[model samples]
Target: MSKYLFKSRLTPDGMKGLLSEGAKARREAVGRMVEDLGGRVEAMYWAFGDEDVYVTAELPGNTSAAAMGMVVSSVGGVRTTTVVLLSADEIDEAVRQEVHYRPPGG
Candidate 1:
């Protein structure tokens, strides 16, 4: 399983639905959606800023993550930007194996 951070902003219409449904209900609904897609929601938050919602989840892979983002974005409610999260062990392993690449103009 891979983890990701999803930063989202709700559209005008989605804001209406959120106001009507309330926070807890919306969070639960999102959790259910993630589960249906074979993923697990780790954490979720609603904030007042450049973004409206933030979510952390563990998904099967990049394909699954992209699919979820596409589905949600297509609904015209939330727009998401996803960041893949890597653990310390994963980074350590990455540092061990490398491909050579010359710097531009080096």
Candidate 2:
């Protein structure tokens, strides 16, 4: 399993639905969605900004995360951006690996 951060902006219909349903219902709905995707929501936040919600979750893999994003976006109720989270150890290990690369136009 891998951790992911999902950020989203609710569409007009999505916002209306959320307002009508209330917070607890929204959370439950999110929980159900995560379960359906074979993932777990670790944390969720509703915010006041360009993005309406931020979610942290554990997903089976990139495909699962991408599929969830696609479904949510296709609903016309939300737009999502999913990012894979890497651990500190993962970054350290990456630093130890050797690769040949050059900056574009360098």
Candidate 3:
């Protein structure tokens, strides 16, 4: 499984739904959506900023993540930006691999 961080902003319609449904209900709904995709929600938070919600989840893979994002956005109530999360060890492994590259003016 791969982890992902989803930053979401609710549209005017979404905000109305949230106000009607309540925060907990919305969170639970998000959790259920993730579970339906063979994933689990790790953490979720409501924030005040460019994004209204932040959700960390473990998903089956990139394709699943993309599908989830697409479905949510297509609803027209929310917009999402997904970031693939990697563990420290994953970064260590990444740095261990190398590629040849040239700077613009090297």
Ranking by lDDT: 3, 1, 2
RMSD for each of the candidates: 0.9, 1.3, 1.0
Top candidate when judged by lDDT against the true structure: 3
Residue pairs of candidate 1 with colliding backbone atoms: none
Question: Which tens-of-lDDT digit does each residue in 74-103 have in candidate 2?
Answer: 989889999899999989999999999999
Q: Per-residue lDDT of 10-63 in model 1, one digit per residue for the tens?
A: 999889999999989989998998898899999999999999999999999999
lDDT (Cα, tens digit) per residue for candidate 3, span 1-106: 9999999999999999999999999989999999999999999999999999999999999999999999999999999999999999999999999979999999
Off by over 4 Å in 3: none
Q: What value of lDDT does candidate 1 attain over all alpha carbons?
A: 0.94
Query: Which lDDT values do the candidates have, in the order given?
Result: 0.94, 0.91, 0.97
Question: Which ten contiguous residues of candidate 2 have the minimum total lDDT?
Answer: 22-31
User: Model 2, stretches more than 4 Å misplaced?
Assistant: none
Clash number for each model: 0, 0, 0
